[model samples]
Each structure stands twice: as structure tokens, then as C-alpha cells.
Target: MEQLKKLDKIKVAIADDLDFFRKVLVDIFEEEEEFIVSGVYKNGQELIKNIFAIKPDIILTDFKMPDGDGLYVIEKINEMKYNIPVILISSYAKQDNEGILECLEKGAVDIIEKPTEQSFKASFDLLKTSLLKKIRYIYNNCVVLNQVKTVESKTTDYIAIGASTGGTKAIETIMRDVKRLSKTTIFISQHMPARYTTAFAQRLNSICSNGITEAINGEKIKSGHCYIAPGNFNLIFAGDHIELTDASKQIVSPGIDIMFQSFVSEAEKTCGILLTGMGSDGATGLKKLHDHGAITVVQDERSSVVYGMPKSAIEIFIVDYILPLNLIAGFINSISQ
Candidate 1:
């Protein structure tokens, strides 16, 4: 909670139709020293009409609200040219639905999945804690980030990314700034449950300048569009296309090493970018890619929420450039040019 001390005393608003949820959320805020709950609304229309008066530091809203949904709240905020970051709470993480993604593109900062069990005692505590942590992160980021987009530069034929924990925002920022992504194929091995990966892909696509989608089995890797290896499966390159295999059996599906190994075999003359993420997932794979003539870059500790992945890569001498998130675009652009 030390990292969150700075966030105590910020204004917040909750827009959900459920009385129980509102009560629980208000209780959590009251217990926190820094959080001040300004208003609670039963519908999107009520919040939209009065939110300007509250001018909350952050907003937490349910996906389905009376009159309008969370997406509507995002739209209303954007229409006013306000930078209020709304976190959308949804009940699903499967089937690749675009409902949450739609709100993100419209200006929602993030989304979290609420449990479907309908038992508040089982889930409310976790939800409240996670939401509080998320709000603090969002507030700090807004203070530091003048722009939501990443800087743009050159892209290479080979790309690899890894993420966990706070990787969602990192991926969105990178994709938003990558205006000139090369036609070469890119692969990401993120640490997440399979059902959640689809949502993550959708979120990335919403903010990215180019295209991004969840990878299908035996699909050919192409340029302009970013590919995420399906959940619970490792993505391996087979000649020109990619394959997803059961990670539980092989013990490494959707893994950075496996993805890079496949790429190095087929395209050693490519570039690899390992962004913010947890664990040493990409370190070994990046070293192999570097050994095979691939350009390698890792995010710096300061820019990374968790420096494990990039730190391992740098220590192993697998990363040729250790740069900040913002400078990565320019560095690659200069070299690629």
C-alpha cells in the first residue's frame, strides 16, 4: 500500500444500478484514507448529467447501466473533451465479445471481470481491492503521461512481446504509437488465461494504429496485423505460418522461447521487442533470437511495471538495446530506416 499512499484523498464516482454493489464500493472507499466517493448513480443518464459537477479523478462503472451502458459514459466524457478514465466492469472474459473493447476505444481506461456467481460475499472483497489498486495506478499514470500514445518508429520482420500484471496498458500504449508497423509478422506471448487473451487482443486493436487479432491455428503470420498466440497454447512458426499447441502438454505453449525459436529458425534476420512483463519468460528466447542475427530490444526498469522479463533479457546479453517505452519507437525507426 506504500505505492498507493499518494492516491489517498482523490475524488471518485461510481455509476452502477445495483444497490448492493454501490454500498460495498462506498464502504471500501470510506475505509481508505485517500479516496473520497463523490457520487453514486443508479443509471448512466444520471451520472452523465451530474458527473461534470463532481469532476472525479476516476470513475468505476458497470457495463450494463440503466438508460446507457459504460460505453455511453465513455462517449459522454469524450464528447466533453475530458480525460476522465473510466474502468468498465463486465461479467464475461470469453467468446471474444467486443462490448468491453468498444468502451475502451471510446476512452475507457480499463476493464475488469466481475464474478457471475451473484454472491457478493464471495467476490466483493477481491473486486474492491483490485479496483482500488487499479485506480491508484491510473491516477499516477495520468499525472505522468502527457499523451496516451507510444512514440512511432520502424518495425522489423520479426517481433515478440511478453506481458503480465500491468501489461495491458503497456501494450495499448505501444500499439497506439506504432503508426508505421512493418509488414513483417509479429508475435506476443502474454501471461494470461486463455479466455482473457481474446479480450486483451480486442483492447489492443481498439487503440492500435494498425490491426491486431487473436491467432488462429495454422494461420500465416502477416505484416501490419499483430498476432497474439491463443491462450493455453504456445505459438510456434511452421515455415511461413504459425501453430498453437496445448501448452499444458508441452509445458510451454504461448511461450516467448518457443515463439522466438520458431522465428529464429525461419527468419533470423528480424527484430524482437520484449515489453513490460513478469517472470523470465522472454529472456532465454530473446538471447536465442539475438544469437541468430535478430535485433533485440527490452523495456527499461523505470518504464516497466515489472522488470523481470526485460531484466533477464538484458542480463543474458540477449537485449541489444535497453530503452524506455517511449524511445523504443525512435530507436527502431532509426535502425530500420
Candidate 2:
């Protein structure tokens, strides 16, 4: 407790149309010395006007603001190139699973569902815990947004990708840079919630030339496409195609290790690429792939948002190359050629 007090309190900005809800956030922060309410605004317009002046470490905004919405705030923040993390709060019904994915794609680090009136006490307790935990996690592992290069390559047989935390953006960068190959099949296992994965897959499909789709159970994994493992299941390669199963009850959905372990038996002419993430989910699996004669690569710490996954793999001495985010696509293309 004494050590915690010595550390700087996290500065938070609140933007919502409801005066009552804004006060509720203030009151919650008042109870905890670890956080300080830096500014409170009634609408997105007000928050946008004084955002830089207030300079809060994090922002909590409602999905539907009178002047501008949460998406507007997020876009404007991105335009300004501020690394500040934003969290959106909405009633569960208002923002469906797709809407939640939209918020994440727009750059909100996380989302919180508002509790109902009847169960305010109990739900608010859970909400407070979830909000603070996400804020701290994102704050500690802030990502450095970087640009990547596009490259065309000869076709390879198979490629596997694992990422988490700030991985959505990283994956987007990688996918955008690579030219679609007719004979290469890409498998991605990104750490995400169940409902949001579908939207994420759709979003990627719209941007990349390669066909990107959410992995389904017993689907024939085809070449010239990218398959994202559904957030509720683990994507495993059974023979020539892919299968989704809930056999592993791991904490993180679409566990990288589970997917990587599945590649050991079918490690013929395979390449495993581990990107930025929070935990050591891909370490052991990547080691297995290496031991089974597969090319293994990890994103270096300098280019990663959170270096936990790659660092874990490096510590285990299984990585073939540690490359920066910008060079990863080129490296992949070179190896395939």
C-alpha cells in the first residue's frame, strides 16, 4: 500500500451525456487513490475541444454522445497521433457484438457494458474492477504505432500467425503489406472475445486482397486465403484442412500454444510467425514447431506493443529470427521466394 501510494496516480478523462453517470465515475475514482479524474465532459464535442489541454492518460467515453460519438473521438485522437488509450462504455443492447468490434477497430482499447438499474450495486462492482484492470493493462503495455512495407512473394504452402493485445493493428499492417499468393494459406490466432472475432475477420477481408474469413469447424483450409481462428474455439489442423474445437479451456480464447502445438505433426514446409502479445501463449508451441523442422520467427521487442510472447519464445531459445514490424512482411516474402 505504501509503495502503491508513492507511484503516480493514473489520470482519467470521462465523457458522457449523463451527468449522473459522470458523477458515478468520479465517485468511484474518489474511493481509489490510484486514480484521479482529470476531466469530465458532457459530450464528445466538449471532450474533443479540451482533450489536448486536459491531457489525460486515458479516456472513458460513451458510445452515443450528443455532438460526437465515441468513434469520432477515437478517430480524432488517432489523427493527432496521441498514444492515449480510450475505453468505451455502452449499454449491452445498444452496442451489439459487431458494434464492439467497430469500436476496437476504430482504436478504443476496450469496452465496458453498463449495468442495469436493478442490479446496479453488484454490476457496478464488477464494472469498476474490469475497467480499472483494463486501464492498467493497456497503460503499462502501450503500443508504438509504426509503418510497414508491402512486398510480393512466390507462393509457400502454409504460414501461421499468433498475436494479442495491440495485435489487431499489427496484423492489419502485415496483411496490408503482403501481396495475395495463390498457393499460400495463412492461419491467424489472435486473442479476442468471441463475438468480436467475426467482425474483425470481415474488417480484414475488406482491406486485404486475400480472402480473409473467420475459421469454422471442419472447414477445408484452402490456399490463397487467410483464416482467423474464432475467438470461442481453438483452430487445429486435422489432415489437410482446419477444425475448431473447445477442448482446451484456456483463459485466452484462440490460444496460440494450442494452435502451434497442432502444427507439430503437420510441420512439413511450414512457417510460424509470432507477433506482439501480452502472455507466453506461443512460446512452447513455437519451440515445438522449431524442433519439428519448421521456420520460426518472432517480432522483436523494439517493434512489439507487448513483448511478452516473443520474449518468452526467445528465452526458450527456439526463434529463428527476431525482426521489426516493418520488415516482417518482406522477410516472409523473401523466405517464400
Candidate 3:
């Protein structure tokens, strides 16, 4: 008797109002061998009602639906403490930037545009690629990170921070809690758009005691000041000065690795902090800093929105301290003092 191969499939649930579009989504997932369509709902209300029974690994939901919307579903999932990653699919993504941002804030892991009848083929092709990438990304980064390395406390003159995804809220919390530094110069490299970085800096400055501003080219670094790396650009150290470089070609803009690597020569005086972010962007650079005797700290898994960056650094055995979100600011203050 010939034995058949059994596949472990990733269960996917969908919630969309339009019948034709819902059918199209089901058809798309049905063609993939690794994916199993677990349940389909016409609106957020139906999905929420049966979510516990379906137990989907991932969810794809339309942004606007009667009875309940994608944002409502995300809020409900958070309230229920369900860890399933949800992705928002919207037809008006091109024009609704604010709405998309709000969805991200509400707990959607990622977002993509829904295919319209006119551009079905082309739009669906890109959507399929992005959708598959996000799904794999969520599962691929499910690395367990509970280990903590003991490190002696050391005073630091320079501080570098890197973050992405849920970084804005994390950064705000840190900056607000941190008392003004007397001699430390902080550098922040957050993944953001060019137009928003200035506004972000302004927001941080209003809440924090330290002077926070977007870094400029060939500017001398000052103590008790925080420099935010401009979006779509890389911030690098140039002997106590800062320089900005165009980073359009790079996979992750405002490359945290570049900023972290620049401190290699002055490692003993620098403190590298990698916060919550996706992928392994800053892990290697933090490793280099650690090898050279620099203080390296990573946000612990439980406190992180996405533990990809910290997990990567931890896996490499280069992290010095793993603290929760609330303790990071105090840790930095203690190190500087």
C-alpha cells in the first residue's frame, strides 16, 4: 500500500462583505498547498462570533464592513487576548493613509490593497506576493527568546536606539519616562516616512525633557540631546558629528545597522539598545558593538510588540541585558549616571 503525504497547513480565516471578492480570496488561498482556508465571514461580526471555533493561524479582513469593520475586529481580538496576527485589506488604501495608520495602531500586523475589477490581475499579483510574505514573516519569526545574559553595569557617553513596526509608541514611552541626561548624547533610528519624521521629533520633544530633533548633515553632536534619523536616510557617526546619506536602495531605510556599526571604533563609550522591531536589521551591528566591549541591551520578548530584532540578537548570543519596556529607560539613565 502506498502511503500518502500529510501536510501541516497554515489555517487562514477571511472576513469581507462583497461576495465576489470573498470568493476570489478563497480561490486564491485554495490554490496554495501550504495554506488551508479555515473559515469565511461576510463581516467582522460573524468572524468575531466564530473566531474561537475556527482558531485560525492568520486572518485577512476587509477594512470597511457593515455591522463591524476591520478596526473593530482588531480591537475585539486584543480585548480577547487572542495572539492571532491580523492583516487589513482595503480598497481605499491609496487614499486613506490616516485610516491605514489607525488600523496598524489598533493591532493589525500588516496591510494590503484589495484588487478591483479593472486591475484585478495586476493588483492581485502584487497582493499575493505581499500577502504571502507577511504570512511567512509572522510565522518565521516565532523564535522563543526567554534567555537573559548577565552583564556588569558600565557608564556610557553615547546611546543608540533602533526600532520599527510598533516603535513609535515604545519610543514615546521611553522618552517620556527618561529623565534628562547630563552628558549622554542619544541617537534614535526609527523606521518612518520622510514627511513624518519631523513631526515625530516634535512630538517627542514636547513630551521629553531632552531636546529631540531630526539629525542634519555634518552637524556636531551635543550632549543632553537626542537626534532622530531622518526617514529614507541613514544616520552615521563622523567623529563626534553626524552625517546623513540617501538610503532609498536599502531594504530597510534609516539603516540601524549603519548607525550601530559606526560606533565600533568607539565601542567602549557607546551603549547600543535594540527595541521592538521586525526582521533582523539591527542584530548584526549590535553584535559587532558587543564584540568590541560595548554595552548592548535588547527589549525583552514579553514587552516587545514584535520581538524579531531582539530575538535575532539574542540568538546570536551577543546581547548583554534583556529588560522589559518599562525598565529600559531607567536602565539607560542608570548607565549614563
Q: Which stretches of candidate 3 lie over 4 Å from their true place?
A: 1-153
Off by over 4 Å in 2: 1-155
Ordering by TM-score: 3, 2, 1
What is the TM-score of each predicted model, taking all chains together?
Answer: 0.52, 0.54, 0.56
- Model 2: residue 185 alpha-carbon error in angstroms: 0.4
> Residue 126 deviation, candidate 2, in Å?
52
lDDT of 1 at 180: 56
**Tens digit of per-residue lDDT, candidate 1, span 97-137:** 68766776565767887665466678877888898888877
lDDT leaderboard ranking = 3, 2, 1
Cα misplacement distance, residue 110 of candidate 1 (Å): 26
- Model 1 gets an lDDT of 0.70
What's model 2's lDDT at 320?
60
- What global local distance difference test value does model 3 have? 0.82
